[model samples]
Target: MTSVGTPPAAPVTAEAPMRRLDRRMIWVDAIQMVISLIPTVVALAVFKVEPRPQVIWPAALVAVLGVVTAVNDLFRWLKTRYRVTPDRVEVRTGLLVRSNLSVPRDRIRSVESTANLKQRLAGLRVVTIGTGRHASAGEATIELNAVRRETAEELRRLLLRGADRPDDATVLAELRWRWLLYNLVNIWAFLTAMFVIWSAYWLLNNFGVELDTWVLGLADWEALGPGVTIAVATAAVGLIGVAGLVIGFVTEFWEFRLTRVRTAAGTALRTTNGLLRTREVNRDDNRLRGVHIGEPLFWRWMGAADTAVISTGLAKAGMGAEPASTILPRGPIAEALRVARLVLGGDDRPFEAPLRPHPRRALRRRVIWALNTTGALTVLLLWLDLTVEALPGGLWLAGPGVAPVAVLAAVVAYRALGHTVHGRYLVTRSGLLTRSTDALDRSAVIGWKFRQSLLQRRLNLVTVIATTAAGYGRYKAPDLDLHDGVEFADRATPDMLTPFITRIPPRR
Candidate 1:
């Protein structure tokens, strides 16, 4: 990757002394390993097992593994040494085979400092430096596992070349207590609650505890009546789910604040949040290509939305990973828009730009797809009912009921399709359950892709894709009129598509 900005003054040379990670990390790793072994110890006690070969063997194996892990961590801590020079940040580590890695300082796109409960207690933080490049194997970022909190903070500012307290820094957003209400309406909250419950049950069952049987014994289902019992059970689950959401929201977003600060290179967006696991991320403004405003169905109904940046090299590393791109949690839609404008450093043109709706053929295409899927599913259910005698006859009623819902979904999806060029941004909106409006920087678009399936070709529709290095790397405007889509892409990034675009004279 090419470097950006000028080299720092008073640059540290390669001869500068390399610094070792905090020694406390070894003790922290040891404590964590011991904590992990607690489950095996508990399992032995709960089962009231004799120290036979089978029981003793597993416990001994776990102890051995824990000891090996501790030893490895200790060796790793002793071997790892990192240093920052004028042009690059470098690290060297390993016992048997030494590994050295270096990244240009100017290529650094983000610097994040995080500390979990254990690390916080030890006055330590984990610092991760992102360059916004994807590695074919392993992580594309550099990490310092455990460092003094003060050292981590100084490193963040040093690597980003950002001011500690810029007078012109502006607070874009902050945590609002009322925003917690949005968490209860999220589907993920209920799913998380159920997952926790199942995990607990599975753990207890593995330890030879009949948790299910004990829970069943606590209830008299027959006397209470099926409907009443179900209602009570649902209420209990709902309460638990809500409680989980509340606690999670509080812990993850406590004292949340988003600030835009001046840096030596340019400006950067900084986010600080968390209660138990504090995190602070600094994203260079130059790398930020756009803003994504997501409105999940439930959150939309509640007038809430979440905001994330469409930035180069800020993509999530894996499933369920939180990236530094996220700027705001679920909050009022107005607040989301306001932050979007602020981040974009302009007026509301990008957010309020009148989007050109996709052709009506798009609507027809969606309806046909929805009906075909619904028909196929209904036929499968009927086949099972008549031939296999598996599903109940009354279950077939779901097929007829689902038809209307599918049509509604198709209509909603059709309404969501829109694209337009707003000033320096190419704005596109799509999706039904979670509609997203992305206002991507026009200059960031590297290329354009036009796709047409058989059905779309027959309908004279095309999917215009704007390819960029940011976010998902591609944003599409689906089911647009062939000519309109071509023109849209051409206008979004002037001259990029003109060379390949063939203009056909209009027929009289």
Candidate 2:
């Protein structure tokens, strides 16, 4: 990844010419055509139909549908036009109903541009404008394809208000090849999980019946033999590994030239490998829930770091998604340092180095996790009445179990670093690799919730979660001075949400 320079200094502007997607719609329209071909081949080739009326009718119907959709798409494209003025974005489109939509600069959440397989090959990109606000109670989104690069950027500038906001801090990070190293670790983790699950099948058949379970239909009971089972499982697991490898290959191939140009519209991750897809994202500093950058000894040695967002939508159960966000292209520690700076909203000293958790909290979390995990394991043991063989051939789960304990330790070190407030600004931190945190102005929280479990109520441990368009985040503070965890609901709620308190339609 090459460090991106500042966005073009001049006011960015552009016009998009309406061009229909290629005749691919023909294939789409010919759903029946494809269905017919299967039967046609069967009847004509195998059955040797004389007139083949069965095949001809479906084929003819498909042909008609294909011709109609293709023609309709042409007119559809002609009627669609995206125009960007310095202040507003006007999207004019209509086929039968006809519609004209405009978003003020402030209304737009993010403007995205990229090329799909077709558009990329044609040297075109797709531009999507997401109006953070909803339309008639629902979120609004728009997508346009096959637009020129300059044109796309021009529109981005208009909606974002300018090509660049001189007042806003600028971050220019280059894409580095070494980033692949992080991905390799990920590949190893995934494959290891697959292999472990497969290897345990022979050993855990009885345990499944006795020990553990999830909500409903998340796990299976039937187990397999390790050797043949592993072979079959390997076929499946190997294919997935191969697929992840393929995506890795593609990311390297496509995003090899990745460069992020941060401008007023958002960030454009430019690539040269010609993947035909470029991801454009606009994030409000206010929406930041957390910024996490990790240089695990493993990754550090490989000269890579994984950074990610810890916004509102962290996760429900178990380890959540990648807070190990960016599989940052590799570079000197300075680059990793700079990336962390960006995540912390360009804070001059945003703890570029890993911050340890509070020792007390770390130990506490570990005790809790260990107790629960071991209790679960115990229950599973008793429930299954397992032989020594059931625990794992030779302690497969031990290594991973220790990892969580380490997290509890990290928590203890980081507890003191918990959510700190500077007036209305809030910042919080948690995690090692998939770690995350959320930092937002108190006023940016659209909504919040305080939840307590039956056990939590007695212990004074409660969880507070805040929600906004950026996503959701939660704070789990336990062992309050009182029987009730020192919950901040009554205070934090109104303080954080006073600004954007509006009715949001249910997620569609």
User: Which residue pairs clash in candidate 1?
Assistant: 132-313
Scored against the true structure, residue 481 in model 2 reaches a CA lDDT of: 22
| Range of the 10 consecutive residues with the lowest summed lDDT in candidate 2 | 315-324
Query: How far out, in Å, is residue 257 in model 1?
Result: 0.4
The Cα local distance difference test for each model comes to 0.83, 0.48
Reference-based lDDT, residue 87, model 1: 74
Model 1: per-residue Cα lDDT over 132-250, one tens digit each: 67733456788898899999978887888745576878999989898888777666666777877886775565466666788789888789899998898777677777888898889
Candidate 1 global TM-score: 0.89
Query: Residue 165 lDDT in model 1?
Result: 70
